[model samples]
Target: MKVYSYSFKEGDLIPTQYTCDGLDISPHISWSKVENAKSYAIIMDDPDAPIGTFTHWIVYDIPSNVLELKENFPKKSVVGNIMQGQNDFGKIGYGGPCPPRGKPHRYFFKVFALDVESLGLPAGLSREEVERFINKHTISSGFTYGLYKR
Candidate 1:
């Protein structure tokens, strides 16, 4: 499995539309070639956050049949049974890159293939909580990174 974004290539600067300077929206993500996965989970984060690793998005319980996530996904806690957890911005769903005024930072868009159908966790979970579940149920993981700056 691999995580990728149509909005930006790995190691490239993410588009402004997906940053605080623009629409502040989540990038369009796509994954493929999953094997024996019953569900998928995604966590988009900026490890370079000034306050330590900051989570920008946490989505879980995605159906294994899913292949791609469209751009500008809803900021809802729950969308069609798929759950969106809170980010560092104190909101559910995505909070795009908003690094401080300095050099560029790396944002990781990580995807996990889980052995279970759902994490059995609730919405509005913190990144650490979601990560615990991801660790327990993950069978495989892949990621793509993008650079961003103010």
Candidate 2:
């Protein structure tokens, strides 16, 4: 499996519309359909954050049939049966890149194919909490990244 975006390519600079300086919406995300994938999960984080790794998005329990997520999704606990968790920004759903000015930070968009239909985890989980569930259930993973700065 592999994740890619129509808005930006790996290692490319993310658009301002997806940043705190702009619209603060999530860019479109798509991935190859993995065989035997019962469900899927997605997380986006900035390891270069000043306060350890900061999560921008935490979503799980996406039906296996979903291979793409549209941009500017609503901030809700559950949308179309997918469970969304809180990010380090203390909010639910996607919070776009917002780094201190000067250096650009790398934002990683990770996708996981799971062996189970659901993680059985609740929504509004922190990044760490979501990771705990992801660690045990992920069968395969792929990632793509983009750069951003204040």
Candidate 3:
């Protein structure tokens, strides 16, 4: 599987509209389908955070047939069958990059193909909690990254 985004190119600078400096909305993202995938999940984070890796978004229970998450995805706990988890910002749904001044930070958007349809987890769970469940069921994964700075 390969993850990608129309909001920005892989390893390119993310546009201001998707960061704290602007709208702070979730960027449009998509991924290639993986064989035998019962469901898919996404975890976006900035490893360059001052306090270690900081999760910007956690989305799971996405239907296997779905291929993309549109721009400015609603900040909801549960939408239809998909679940959005709480980010390091203590908010539910996407939290755009807001790194401190200086060097640009790399935000990684990772997509996982799960063996199960759902992790049976509720929304609003922390990244750590959700990741624990994802790790157990993940079959294949791919990622893309964008750089951002204040």
Candidate 4:
């Protein structure tokens, strides 16, 4: 599988509209379909965070037929069948990059093609919890990233 973003190219600087300095909304993201994939999950984080890897977004139980998540996705716990998990910021849905000034931080958006239609997890779970379930069912995965700085 291959993950990509229309908002920003791989290794490119993310626009301000998607960061804490701007609207702080989720950027539009898409991925290639994987054979035998029953569902998909996305985990976006900043490994350059001062507090270690910080999760910005967690989305799971996305229907396999769905290919992209639109920009500025709602901050609700549940949006249709997709479930949004809590980020390190203690908020649900996307939390745009807000890294401290100095070096730019890389924000990775990882997508997982899963064998199961759902992880059977509830909304508002932590990234660790969501990842644990994703790891067990993932059949294929890919990632794309963008850089940002305060």
Candidate 5:
């Protein structure tokens, strides 16, 4: 479970493109060492969110052969024939970080390697629920973090 992206680096400031400062779009992502994974799940969230856990992005059912997701990928859009679930913004697709106007917040980008090809979930599932679902059937997982401040 390795994660790579053109987005902000771990502990680096998130670009404005995914925040209120820009397009509010999602960054591209790729992975490796799935280790026999039949499918994959991706969840991006901010635990530093003023609310508890805030979902920024949720995607699942990615085919095992896929290695990357392009920039500005939509929540409901399919990449390599994969499907996306709901995010905390109450929409499907990636939502960039928008922390409060003071301290920087940490955004987590988590990926799950699953044994099943699909989780059979609908398009608008929340982050917590998605977390539970992924944890229930994950074979391998890994995560990277990015920071942002408003």
Candidate 6:
């Protein structure tokens, strides 16, 4: 799969709205050329954290045809086209970066194209576990990176 977005260009700044400086919502994401994908999954995390990898967002079971997730989605209601899993914050949905103040950190936003509609994994999984699960099930995948600093 090839992942792209309307919010920002690949390798460009992800915008303050998706960070601690703004609304802290998820930006729109899109992908194409996914092979035999029944659903899509998105995982946003910061590997540069001082302690370990930190998950910023977790979403899955997104209908393959359904592209583009609006900013700040699922804030008060289900967006109807997808389901969200818990992030490192132990909450369901998007959680923007709040890295310890200091130098800049890199956040990876990855998209996975899966052959199955559901991975059948339970919610509230850690970023490490989720990465392992996606590796086992992904048919195609792509990613974008953004940097933020205090």
Error of 4 at 56 (Å): 0.3
Cα deviation of 58, candidate 3, in Å: 0.3
lDDT of 2 by residue, 54-93 (tens): 9999989999999989998788989978999999889999
Q: What is the TM-score (0 to 1) of candidate 3?
A: 0.99
For each candidate, give its TM-score against the true structure.
Answer: 0.97, 0.97, 0.99, 0.98, 0.90, 0.86
Ranking by lDDT: 3, 4, 2, 1, 5, 6
Q: Estimate every model's Cα lDDT from 0 to 1.
A: 0.91, 0.93, 0.96, 0.95, 0.79, 0.77
Q: Write the per-residue lDDT of candidate 5 for residues 9-51, one digit (tens) a residue.
A: 7678778887867898887777786778988888888888778
Task: Name the weakest run of 10 consecutive residues (lDDT summed) in model 4.
Answer: 45-54
For candidate 5, which ten residues in a row score worst on lDDT? Answer: 74-83
Question: 3 or 5: which has the higher lDDT?
Answer: 3
Which structure is stronger by TM-score: 1 or 2? 2
lDDT accuracy of residue 7 in candidate 1: 88
Model 6 Cα lDDT, one tens digit per residue, 12-118: 77788888788888887777757688888889889999878888888877787876676677742135646677787788888887888898888887888888887
Please give the RMSD of candidate 4 to the true structure. 0.6
lDDT of 6: 0.77
Model 1 residue 121 CA deviation (Å) reads: 1.2
Candidate 4 lDDT over 55-127, as tens digits, reads: 9999999999999999999999999999999999899999999999999999999999999999999999999
Displacement of residue 36 (Cα, Å) in model 1 is 0.8
- Model 1 TM-score (2 dp): 0.97
Which 10 consecutive residues of model 1 have the lowest summed lDDT? 1-10
List, residue by residue over 78-122, the lDDT tens digit for candidate 3.
Answer: 989999999999999999999999999999999999999999999
Candidate 2 stretches greater than 4 Å from native: none
RMSD of each: 0.9, 0.8, 0.5, 0.6, 1.7, 2.2
lDDT of 6 at 117: 80
